[model samples]
Target: MNRYQSNPLSLFGMVLWLLSPGIARADGHQVSDPMSLARDLVHRMTFDQKFILLHGDLGVDFHTSKKPSGAIGSSGYVPGIPSLGIPALQETDAGMGVTNPLNGRPGDGAVGLPSTLATSATWNIELSYAGSDMVAREARSKGFNVLLAPSVNLAREPRAGRNFEAYGEDPLLTGTMAGYAISAIQSNGLIATLKHVAYNFQETDRNFYNVMIAEAAGRESDLLAFEIAMGLGKPAVVMCGYNRVGTVWSCQNHDLLTRFLRQELKFDGWVMSDWGAVKAPSDANSGLDQEAGAQLDKSVMFGDGLKSAVRAGVVSQQRLDTMNENIVATMARQGMLEKHSSSGQPAIDIKGDTTIARNVEDEAIVLLKNDGNILPLSAQKRLKILVVGGRADFGVLEGGGSSSITPYGAGIRIKADGEGEMGRRYVDYLPGSPLLELRKALPNAEITYTDGRYPSMAATLAHQADVVLIFATQWMVESFDAPDLSLPEGQDQLISAVGAANRNVVVVLETGGAVKMPWLHDVRGVMEAWYPGSGGGAAISDVISGQVNPSGRLPVSFPRREADAPRTTIPGFDKADGAMFDIPLIEGADVGYKWYYKHHSNCLYPFGYGLSYTIFSYSNMNVTHQHDVTVTFRVRNNGRADGKEVSQVYGLFPANDGKREIRLLGWVKSGLRRGEEKNLSVTIDRRLLANYDTKLGRWVIPEENVMLVIGRYAGEAEIQFPLHLQRAEFSSLDMVKPH
Candidate 1:
């Protein structure tokens, strides 16, 4: 039996394997302390064996050997010492699903969930856990033990290509969602890695730049997000990014890796370097436990070099011992020390998994505009519907790069680096298409489909239909930042021509991040269906056909143009060679809606902004305080249809507090029947009201009157209530426990 199922200790008790160190083994047998066990294992190892364990060992095996009967291609692998009873650890890519190519077996690869941004839009922590659990289960079924996922970095840059992989600008939202995902992944017997640590907010020359920001600025924003996730999830591993923070690379920065993550946040996990991120052997003492993918990239910084450095007293023997102990302890905590293998060709619960994906999309599809109630298109009217552009007949556009997954019947698009393209790309398409699903859902309507190859031709076709549904696509790939927010491949021009040709037009945007909607005023309705996953097609069909009401909200604010961004210009050079420069986070803690509110700027769409098909009224608000602040309110679906409303709460602090800004304290999703009212309570963590006082070396909760705003969106609120906080301060680990 698998230790995960048969072990007697509860999940929380298992954490004592690191702390108590005197607990009995999984079997009914007495064992030495975990530190003694790790030290004993290290004492038996030779220099060569220890050297091999420090870096990656999967390159030769993956390139020249055959994979296991049900395994996918390797992401990272480190061979264990067989004589010492340690088993190898196999890691896989992504948050959505297994992305590596699987062995030839039925259901080898699994379906994907919606993007992190989409799930964040739902503002439901339980749903986030369910989605991440599904992904971890599929990964374990494919013989993987570690999932490099739940990127918690803030979306500080609007043009970042990998925004779909992470939650948005607000630290509370991003950290809360990531905590749920990490807990879900590890709870299913897989190790979850909190990745791209610190400020990996942009992809432009990411590997060739240093991020310069004040310590206080980081403590309030990006760094705070990491602390919140670490406190809640207690992830098994943390993957350091490639960039430098200040003068040292993040993989080897003692202040970030040791002083902040370890000493302050109290994260007990091991730290690993991003692929090819190691730069020096002296990094052994900088809090990095292992170097991954160095062998594949042909990097010679660690390995024999580290061993020699330790032998020469350049890198201390104590440092090497500490690293080895951290790795072994983490493995033991995750039950990876035993013989690990998957049940071949897992018996997939098709219906259950599909429902999970569909429900997430149902909650995440944002309706930006529904002028004159043009949406929920009347299927009973038997009207002519023209579905043009966005390659909807082919597949949904999956987010590009390392996190891309191959669904049951997915297709591939290979675009080489040429002309204006930034890098070589391979994009996978979700199996089912929206056009086909829409046809299946509304069989009574005259539904015509087109690839929209030519703008003029597409416009001509739009004129013949009673209503036009133009699909606009914006493709985002890793290793580069988008040059601008404009839709790629002249998609804006196509939307303009189609909107001009038909007055009753609705636009559906398939994008990784925010894109400029040039024709927003011209269209009757617009939906931001961000990179919805395998079940996206059906979700969209349900929303447009009035089968499911749209409930998703924008996680990040949408600006009218590039200049409206907090930082107009980012540091970059034309050359591909490795050159370094400093990229300063000038706006500091002011990001997304905080920046807009502070500057009084014009925004295309505000954060937490989404239109629902049914109208919902908020009333009878009340606030209570214990260890945390709890807000209760009555929500009634006033419109004639049943729908779900995401109620958000924001804290408005005194204007004199420059270090802090208005924050999303908490949110809840309430599903109501027509004219039905339900009372819901959302808890606001008291820690959010505190600010890190560097001088005092603690989080200080000031005694002041704070106005809590219950809002339909970030900028627009329905009601305001006041609270008085008594002055208090807390140590680093005070709020680490789950609220």
Candidate 2:
């Protein structure tokens, strides 16, 4: 003190520290060890303080004078307690990128980034990691310590409202990509939250719908993907889904939350409730650490409900204590309490973001068909192109909801008429159409466009054009499910008219998920340009014009007929059923390819199925382990041009214990040049060999030979490899106790 008194600033600091004990604790010599500091802070917190710490601290922004307020004072930022010297943790929603909040102001549009489907298409884990890092940097700059992202849910259904937010359908692919995203976000000194914890595939009646999945199906198809994601990502927080299951809602299912996620999977993260997902007091019994997006407009009260539950003995104090400990631990681990000087500048570089986004877009476009080599449209003057359909000019390229990201002001606009009308009514919820970009990409060609319903008095125009391109769009929104897989109202009619009128007709589908293609046979070429994002228009033009070869694969199975879908039997799907809709997951884990292959149902397109401009060959399939197999293949660009090919590997365990069809073990993407071949290897694990036996209530390995298949799609390149399994005393210990 005497030495400090010599310096005026030191003396003032000493006085300030002495005057405020809270400040002293906050400014207390920086603790080099975060864990020890966290322990010390926890040891000093009172039970009530601990409970508060367990609750989520949400904010509209940092400096607003609002206090933990949302609806009815329930929606506000969680304040830091000066007495306890505990800083509130900040969290933000970012499955794709940082979504700017929409203030109640005119033209306060939401910013959107590329869809998860587009990100996954890049097949570049580093790009996803970079994207997550950029998002995390923005969040941290705004005082957020947690970023809820890397939605690992399998894209089981194409019509799913949230499919664009998740990694594609394959478990291994989704898992690997999600892992990179998690690492990127967490690496930035923030906690990453993997969402919709368990089987949350479809959004149809998501909140109250019951998923009646068989244990086996659930494990192999849906749960296997999540297992891979959880193992790789190792997120700091897990978000429970709102859907209901056999005995309980996913959010309130203790067997799923505590036993399965925490125990078996070894998920050490804190569990948070989805917005307004907690239906009753029992929901808290699932060991949920925090109630997020708590609103006062709803009947679900947070503070009072929690406190009353404790008072009424519905919730044990120990359980509450444990939740609090988890929350505190997560906060401490993220270093949320530590304050730092602001750079007062953007954390992410815009140029770098654009570069990454463009690169990802180039990789995601899938070229389904290209007949007569019309593509890579020659730069000749004789070519006359006619682009039809309202969507062709102005279609929604990205999905809606939390993941939506709008780039900064006046982005690269395409020159097109009627594009503005597409946003007249739904301006707040649509993406840029692909027409302008396509026209720009092909400046030398004569491009004509129409905006009315397809098949307008445009048959004459179509016949006159050298080639006719029809863009078909489908609209699927949140809190609602798609009615069917058929192309939207006038789309099929237009395709039929245009195809019949012109011999060289190409169909470009701008849909979020799979759609029934009744006009498949009529069209000469088809491109599934799924919600391409900001650069979607360019991507579509590139693929169609042969500038970029389509490498995208179907993440989920495409049903040939509507009735073939697994959820066709779910009652109340088409009818209204209040808050409790009858949207049942009757198919269980056998979704997408699993369901199709298991039932041997005919599909329009199998999972991981996609056609490229060039041809590829699969060969050299071999088994490397008693339980695992390595399928080596050569991807030859048979065409005159070079392209990339995704080699898929499928595994089938014999139905010794009445098992279902073959399952997808792993896949690899190979790049090739014209007339060049590349070697690829895909391995399957022993765990994937085990099947869930309901009779025995355990995962058992039957003493039977397993079959392994390698091809571009399911049941395409058929091969049989048998592995003998030694039967042992298989106990239901893991199934019953479940971690």
Candidate 3:
């Protein structure tokens, strides 16, 4: 089979009359048509003025990129023309929250939302939307009109440095969650960007590597994710990758930009290059609409260089016109041209936003193991508890990178290793100490704390206490991926010593992605509190103290060891720094659990896997496939406690090679009272069931016996039903809101 068998705003006019602050929430719904306004303004713009919209600069002086006068210092800034009433695009690093890069705005900070992996774990679309809306509102209030986030990139490489920024491994889950994030952010009149298109998977050699993925594999895995997100969110801007999509840089790849994104998927928004990603002026012809952070490039690829190209007929007038139109139309689509930004912007409500963060993590923190059901410890108990390590007495751990958020109340910083951003990769710790929160949660328990730097000291305390609680941390950052799955900083040794010393030990993990638990056999319980955000400590207290039921599932599989990874070693990890290397993505559509399923190997924890305090059973399975697939099942809470359940459905299809391909069709998160039975239904998009036929350039579901594997996690056979499917091909994907 050929590689690509399957896959895949101008409202500019209204001026001052629409500038009322109260109408800031107004979107294109309440504004004049965007395209009409853009087309009309295209004729009014001067020849030189049109070039202004094609490039932007890294608008901060963190490392000598001079910001334009009156421009907000941030990740990227496009100066607006006062004559045209075009507002400047002030973009901030979001996805986690609005990060104060280098504490640019002193005393100003954003509310930290849990890592995207945590949200991906929640499997809750409504929760994702609410959290993103809160962050978007905060960004707008802080004078930023664009959020450089909602990265819909698939987690093709588990060890990839940017995995924390993405929405898990599955294309459907990542795309759907990111789509909601886009919609929520845009609804607040701020642009949410969907980014890092086409196999920008690993961060090692990110700026120089050339990814040579099979056309079909590229289309079905990562590109499918970008496609699904575009259909739902309709984002105003799409950020191209820094690395090459094949031999051609993604910013200048005509097949990816013009044919796939612009033509096939009907993505009308402008394509913005990742900071410093542009290669040449001819990138304009290949569908790159704008060069972001142009100062980061060796030479300005768009400003004077692009002008020269157009003069020499290397870039056509039509391409430049389209680029200009897209920029203006997007500004209008988000009501940016209509609404004026105030320098005296309202202050962010950190307290209110933190509440939203807590609510999200309340359902997002997964209970990996509750052996002997030892969790939900009673507050009235008089037992002595030992709190060890992870700086639990100080603050919670968070991954370091562009997405790391500065705390509004108080931020803790520990200088870390690396050559990132002027050798300033500082490890951040969110406020709200887990030890203090636990003290409040269990007022009667006698609790003692230890830093856990000395394993012997932690072991001694663990032996003296009736029960032990260890807060473990693993820091995953951008620029460099984790070396292995084991906990960093000798944390596993500390955990092992403590686990051996205590009869009852419960571990709370604050990490960026999956980690190996060498002491799993010694621990009584394990809770994955993935960078739980602003309310992280309190959320951990709520779950362990029985205040909230745990429902979050694993978005990515946890391998037994790094050796079990799809790629044992990162591509070009040992290669020369400035030399280009080839990255052949051989995994194809099988990523995360799919890879494990194909190998018939068992991971530490499977995708969509989590343990809850209460028991729930699935029964009365019914499947109907007509226009689409609908799965209805009855969920009954067998335990006496009320809880929430996430029922996952995986599709099993026969492959031409006799092996089968497994994909996540859909899932539903339902709430159930004690002993109550509820009927829940999940509608599967047909495109998810169909494979991209590179030959036909369409999604096809070949005639075969398709089985629906419905359970809490992949491979679990709670309810399995088989139905034969007729060959169905779709020329287009329906981006309708999922049920």
Candidate 4:
């Protein structure tokens, strides 16, 4: 007769609660509390039901139709149990943004967001969060609970095709930014995944390439970022990449999947495979719970192969149960079952969308070089300008593939004067040119443009113009990474030809990432206008016409030549065997600015390098805590231009031998008007000073002297401060957090 006692009637009620479809709604409890419901439902599921959930509902229309199939077949969704009312969980593609199919465009549904490279340049966590929120809204609205995003991969090579979709080369920056983005999406009642589990840097033979990396290098640069995101974001899902290390593929590597990701990193979410990433059936035995983007070849995700493995004692039933438990737990964490019954909200607000896109584009447009102070062009006069290049009239903005976005309306276009003929042939998939937008901004200017491919034609136009703006674009599309860093064949030739005819030339480059600039010396001005999304034309015009000062910095290192790249030793880069190159990663932990700083090699441009219309100075750097420091500086618009300046803070750790070297720790962006000075402060944590020691098998902090550097960018003249650590042994966990 006790209230808490489970007598016959009470036991019957508990059983009824376990099987009731209406229990969640009948209890008047919020559906958002999926964990509680999942715990209850999982206890009642049969072994077969648990196995089906773990392998995912593999159907041809899974991502498209929002349906689940019991078996791994390319057909309509086959219900696991019609009477049980257990709906299947569906996932969608998204490293940059929501990838929905549109008019036969595979994986195109909603208006995608900007690439990771563009977001990284902005260096604004809030912007990334907003973008992810939009992607989540779109994904949910399209009937998908899992939104795969925040691809936290390292940008080790400049020529990597996927570079546009990754944050940057630095582990701290990439992890922090990706973590914020994932958190934002997941917090909105949807699940955001952190992907390419480890060391999937290059796309060349991505499906079968062997990424030979030293354990130290992988831990320091690649794995460090993944661990940061996992600890901070706690993504609902982790997608395994299609790369191999030593002899084990990532999807089939027990050491990586079980020992590292699940146990060491303490990740409790389900691990899914990249499209066709699982090479053999045994891959699932390595702690992978699901096969996402499952193709037609894998006949039964949880059928014959799994049954055979269990019967043969290759994979125990306990392991299968554990995997299923993880999947069910993740589904509960994502509120998949509860949210599945309701409809979703809209993807974006039209007005807010354009404004955010423009702001991000403005922040990401890097001003590389400006001599004679020609930038922020005087808008008072009807300047005679000539806009020429293949991508001038039709803007070459944003990268292609899954990250591509189609804005609500036609983006702002640059306008030009005279008989300028826009390129009729669309060679690539980018949006319109900046010329149309520039023309609209400068209606009074007498502008003329011609296809710069013809030297004589460009010469004739340049001779008659007072200023020439050349749009040099590099389009690196799908299934291939760039061969070299050089500008396209015709672009380099056109720049050289036009520069000879006109000294007042402004080169605007539209590329996914860095490209070698052989003609940098010839042009008077340069702008690294990365594929600037939909409103790129307007952003370019604003920078040129004194409306917006360029504040973007080089997120990745710009090598002076292709040979300067660390991966250049890999031969047959352009051939089919290019994906099979066996070159060693001798550079190891020293990548990007690290390599340049250590070796004292001259680069075309150092990482985080950017030019502003104004000037800023660093001083009064004070170390408050042994593990933390706050630096105060002054940024003055010395130039007679209203613009913004980004103050970069770098930290240098003295080697165990007492030698001094500097590396970037953190940075802040500030805005100021002409002749106005603004005070700025930035803090750096002690953990940013740790280095991975191969012999020690852990991150080590030198007990010797540590130097603090504050500069405009990497390799610049830096203001220095010194400190000493009493103890040197510090784990990555201690370093990421301050005392």
Candidate 5:
């Protein structure tokens, strides 16, 4: 018989091969390729088995767990196929520690790191790494292998409810910080996910709004931030947003996924849809690999319908195989498939984690204004102190949303009778309190407290105290945009009244993002504590009592007025009650400080602006160019105490270049003793000098010469150096280090 001819014995062998899901390659060969391994597994999987991997597993212990809906405790679980030897995947929410999975504190308790905005304000990249590592450890301790964290989304719109979850307004700063966090999380053996892919700036119409942004504009701003993160972090997964990009949902956008992310940016990771985000079976071919949280609510985005679609050739086998390969390949590369089967929770050090959280909070406390130097309250003077408003004794305010972290102690429950969905939730108040900590630090002094319910009463009380600490807060949640930037609930009026009553007034703002400070000039000292974490209380005491020097800088500009921002009126949907409308990103590259630079507008506090207990001066600027360019300067701590300073370097391309403006080229943080000086250098990535040339399909050098400016903040450069630009075109931000 011919070798190609099939007999009874040959037919039996072929059937056996097909039945064995663990068999080798189709050609009876083994290849050492990750993709090949994934493909081999896909070929053996049945349509039903393949469909199961496309959605979450109904294994979350929600009924027994205390976590609220949409919280980490309610996060979905996915079971693996035992026959295929794939272990179950346990996922959790956020970089701010493993969010209270039970919705409330469970056992010995977990740590809550400072909000992402607070961490970013430090302008210290190493802190990002440290914070991520600690959080990842907590995730492992909770028996989770995936961290849905390190949101690289830009704070493009100040009112963006999730602004606290993002890094900052600028792409360079946001990308650099997120990259470190992503790398650190993965380094701890957990998968890190970069989220809310494109133009997810507003929460008002998040689920149905369409972002009609120009492709080129998108690439340079928010997309640029994601690109930097993807190149540096190489995260295992990319979570698409709930809204549409242009006309299609981000989860089902072919251009965004297959064309941009997969082709131009070279992201090889699998794509996962945001909870209840996938809307059609055709989305299977458009880059959505998994539909998350589907089993929780029994949503039927992908199940029997997907299997039928595949069988009928609506979604080709090639597309189905591609999805399976992406998922399996990512799991294999991350070693998730190998070690996920292990049992027992990893070790967690509560005290150690608290220390990390405190350190970040201490460094992130921005001293926006210190008019009379009334801050660093002298321990030698025995004086009366008054702490007003914001439930300082209760807990620090945390941003509301999925990123909200439940601390280690008693969880605060809200009354649901008169509250909205975002308002009626638990607030975890751990071991620290600003009021208690402040009282402990000033034992000899008489400390008084007030709710500040009556402005006149509070103002009268403030006048009697030797010093006043007014704690003002504003809440920002994910489902809606802030009504305005001003301090809500008459806090601004209270602050203004108190400032008028006492010249020694100090305002401690516990907020999610920048707030309009009408009392900025009247107060003696101002602190922007952007949602400091569980240990925020102790950190605040340290800064006020002179135990720690203030080093945090403003990551986003505090525009003098809301109108000073890029867009005064963010366009409304203008559609029917449930219909979708489009909003374009017309700002282009002129975002944040760039907009201020072009408009020459006066901001209340520019990006990178901050004041320390000690003063620093910079001089001796020098520049050198080779394959890369470097700027060196001497930073001297010209004061009586040691402190840290973040030196910012900016670049301005020639007008002849396609885009002409000042950009944050590089930055570095330095700590020095009083009167000590250090020669520090900041390197400018050659990629920073170029813009994405869509037509050329590469980053092109735009100018022959670039001007370098060094200073403590943007628009306030102390020195300038001109440097020559070379290497016209290239790709890959892996070679670039902006910090």
Candidate 6:
């Protein structure tokens, strides 16, 4: 059980040991410690060499500026000082895969995992790590060191464009998932980036708007997710967001970068600005270690302007040295400074990586509604199945933006209508044709497909089948927030038309986030497939064909209507270009399910809500609280089918001076045979039970009764246990854990 010791029997142990920093080797040398190594390297560097480490070119340099000679044309690049044995920080956008933007590296492609939200939905930390490691292996093969990924930002705003790229709304789930991902990347000797360090809620005018929330609220919610991720992963880099946290830009914000991230969260890595995030040269003095994509910024402050500031004594030499040290330490911590061998390294396992992606997607496909359990598509019955719409006959839809891959089969691409790179965003689909997979799943069944371009024609085609599946999609990406929650491009009308003709209509949603379902009652089944990556087609077919039981829970709630959300309209949607807008989060930490619970509003589907082909029932529940609250419950697979079930535990913390924490304490996913019963125990994450106290400057767990529930979803408290807890306070979150 020693954290420092590797357990051959435990894959988790191996992961920790592989990723844990300062672990000494047999030669009495710390495997990857940057402190001593970075200090020595910095002392030997010339002023010109120091500046080389400070900034670099965009790997996908579309600008007129000369691209850095060392750039690999990935995402960001910084030249290495060969004299100091520093490796060039070759960066890549790794939200899902090793991106070759615009096919910059001709004929280059890598396997893409399911959307991050999909991975988070699985609630399987082990799988999260494995998927990330798969991608990391491919990244290292392509000679990239830094991976900008495992985004931990809460999916509080469902309409937020990049929600598909991040984890989920809950701090506990998102953080834990990201932690494992970060661990996996770093373990593979790549610098994993835990990014967008603060509240980067929406993409509308991201560079001009500010996310206004109280410090305490920010800590308990968004910042809390980052805190847990950092504690578990110790990621090599923390990318500053493009938005403003309060009055100052996140990169230049003293409290965000220095106080909260560096001091409070105890992040050892340096802070790098998002591509062109720095506003001024003085922003460097506020804790930005490096400004990547210098050309993207208006002033190129981290470049020529930074040099001027250094000469004018506006920025100290000591500060510059510290910045250099932080960057080198991260690289050194991963042994990037040392000469390594590829002789022993394994080749890229594309097939193996694809399997990992499919496994995650299989678990991530949440069955929202399955009336009469009309799933597992009875192979014994010679049935006619019709699959229509969303071009599933060709490929499965993936969210657009930098995270997208050209995919293995590389079938189709529908370019978006706009101006620059964001304008060039396309409604891309990965190479996983669901129609083909479904046909393969049920060879005996007669299946046909239509594009669903016309409502009446698709409806007519629906009448000829035993079951009709409408593949609905809502494409979202960076630089644009979804106008609303409804499915776009007349898909809803198509579904309605098809549903009117077929009673057994199933709407398979391949959306970026939640979408309004007006035809909910009309459809027999609903599946939230999310933006399934390269392996999506097979993963979707796996669940519908009952090859794998659906276990994915809603990471974010689906509101009945867009009005039910905290923000009815995106903050800066209608504002003028240069005018700064504010996203005042008065709801604060009461986000996601908490906000709905607080307002007593009803959502179409609640967080942690999912269905299986089989049924599960809970009993024999017991709760106890000492230093931490522990719950033990019995779960039985009541139905005839063998299946996996995700038991979510929700807790309503006692009110503390009118504030309380309604959060997910923990969850366990288990596979049980038909009629089998098993007991499960969860040691509540004490951090979720506590509230961040601004005045006291600490986390405070109040003395009050906690309303606990072992439920299938957040909306239900089917099994309840009310327990009282004494007041507890921790000056540091690290002190709250059991030693």
The models' CA-based lDDT, in order, is 0.78, 0.63, 0.82, 0.65, 0.76, 0.82
- Model 6 ranges off by over 4 Å: 1-19, 22-29, 341-344, 420-422, 656-661, 733-739
Best by lDDT: 6
lDDT of 3 by residue, 119-185 (tens): 8888887778889989988888878888998897777777777888888999889987887788788
| Lowest lDDT block of 10, candidate 6 | 1-10
Residue 715 accuracy (lDDT) in model 1:
63
Question: What does candidate 5's lDDT look like per residue over 299-394, in tens digits?
Answer: 566777677788788898888878888888766666555533335555678888889999999999999888878888877778899999988877
> Tens digit of lDDT per residue, candidate 4, span 1-739?
2221122112322343242222132224346544455556666776566555645443445344443434222211223333344556655555555543232234333443556777777765556766776666655665556666778888787888778888878876687678767766776656667888777777666666666778866777778888766655667778888777766788888877887677566677778777666666567778787765544335555556676777688878777666666765565554444434443355456456545666777878788889887776775678899998755676555565545554444433232222322121112333545777777777788877786778778877898888999888776443457777878666887888888888899998888788887777778999887777656677788888868877787778888877777767323355474255443566666667777776677888888888877776555566665445566666566777666666677766554334445566666666666777666566654446677776765566666676666776787755776767565665555433210
Query: Candidate 2 at 247: error in angstroms?
Result: 3.1
Ranking by TM-score: 6, 3, 1, 5, 4, 2
Q: Which ten residues in a row have the lowest lDDT in candidate 4?
A: 1-10
Q: Judging by lDDT, tell me the better candidate of 1 and 2.
A: 1
> Residues 623-707, candidate 1, lDDT per residue (tens digit)?
9987777888888889999887888899877645463367788777777889988877777766678777889878888999898
What's model 4's TM-score? 0.85
Name every residue pair that clashes in candidate 5. Answer: 67-102, 67-103, 73-101
RMSD of each candidate relative to the true structure: 4.9, 10.2, 5.6, 9.7, 10.4, 3.0
* Candidate 6 residue 94 C-alpha distance from true site, Å: 0.8
Predicted structure 5, TM vs. truth: 0.90
Candidate 6 has a TM-score of: 0.95
What local lDDT score does residue 18 receive in model 6, on the 0 to 100 scale?
A: 53
Q: Write the per-residue lDDT of candidate 6 for residues 558-643, one digit (tens) a residue.
A: 99987888889888889998788788897888888898887888999999999998889999999977877788888899998888
TM-score of each: 0.92, 0.84, 0.95, 0.85, 0.90, 0.95
lDDT of 2 by residue, 1-739 (tens): 2221121112332342233211122224333554455556667776667556544433543234344443112122444555755665555667656554433112322234467766776555555666676667666665566677878788666567777778777766677677667766765667777878677777665766666667677666666666665555556788887877674877788877887677666665588877667766556788677777665215434466777888888988767666666665555555455555546535556556555555566776665667776666765555788888745565444555555555544433232222432232122323445677767777788888875363656677888899888877765444545667777667787788878888898888767777888877777888777666554566677777678877777666778877787656334466564557544565565556777777778888777777777877655556665434455555566777777776666766555347546766766666677897766565554446677676654566666665677777776764445555565334333322211
Better model by lDDT: candidate 1 vs candidate 6? 6
